[model samples]
Target: MSRRPADRQRARVYAWEDRHVAPHGGDLLPFTAMQPMVNAIWAELGLRYPPAVEPLPRQARRLQADANRLRLRVPEQLPSWVLLHELAHALSSTHDGASDGHGPCFMGLYLQLLERYLRLPMAQLAPSLAEAGITWDPAAKPVFLDAAPAR
Candidate 1:
């Protein structure tokens, strides 16, 4: 089957991460600490978990991609919620076999998982996301998935 737009976009993000984000201090982030959380979310959502976590290069700016894994830029400073946001993307992509494009479904599921796993309310999560330059608006354009064409 042909790859979906979301899949391609996800790949692009991964590429960006690999080339620009991984080379810096990205490895110092709490990757191990985040694994269990990611797995838990994946199990709950019934998604295939990625085999491993790898660091993307560091020059990554607004856009980045990692190796079929999570793709995120390393901010000069990162907030705790940033981890959760990327985790949500990873889980959603794995479970659905397609990127949800950070849309309402993705955000709704993410918020639920965040509350359950992190014990943080949506209100609390929003500010942290905003602080990290992550968008809280579900209607915002997603980086990965897009609407499929009508047959």
Candidate 2:
């Protein structure tokens, strides 16, 4: 089966994770654990799955146009699931009206995709979701805040 764009992108990110992130003793559990979830989601949705997994930064941002085109910036510090979640945002076509923000609907859809694709219970995923620092608020503007200054 042909690979989906999101899955291909994910694989690229995973390679980055192994090279840059893993050598530094970075934890890959979050990224490694989500594959089955993604595959499950693909099966449910009947979308083509990719071979590689990419680990996206936590503070990544995605730009979307009405035509369903997306530009993603993968953060080095972000977990792979978070990156996939943002990709999910694009795949599901959950965009706010005119403004670029992750609103309640977008977040809800993200959660639904996570559940369906990741085969994870909502409760099990909540902590990971919280760790990824994703918030759902339609009125809020999307911003890429700098990581906290190192101590």
The TM-score, computed over Cα atoms with residue i paired to residue i, of candidate 2 is: 0.34
Task: Give the number of colliding residue pairs in candidate 1.
Answer: 16
**lDDT string, candidate 1, 1-151, tens digits:** 7766543233443343344333332433355554554466556655453435445566665543322234333333333455555665654454235665554455655566556655656676565445444334444332333433457
Error of 2 at 126 (Å): 8.8
Q: Model 1 off-target regions past 4 Å?
A: 1-29, 43-51, 63-78, 94-97, 122-151
TM-score of each: 0.45, 0.34
* RMSD, one per candidate, in order: 9.8, 15.3
Candidate 2 stretches greater than 4 Å from native: 1-68, 75-78, 92-100, 123-151
The 10 consecutive residues of candidate 2 with the worst lDDT sum are 139-148
lDDT by residue (14-70, candidate 2, tens digit) is 344244333433333344454464455445655453223444544435621111213
The local distance difference test score of each candidate is: 0.48, 0.41
Provide the global lDDT of candidate 1 against the true structure: 0.48
- Candidate with maximal lDDT: 1
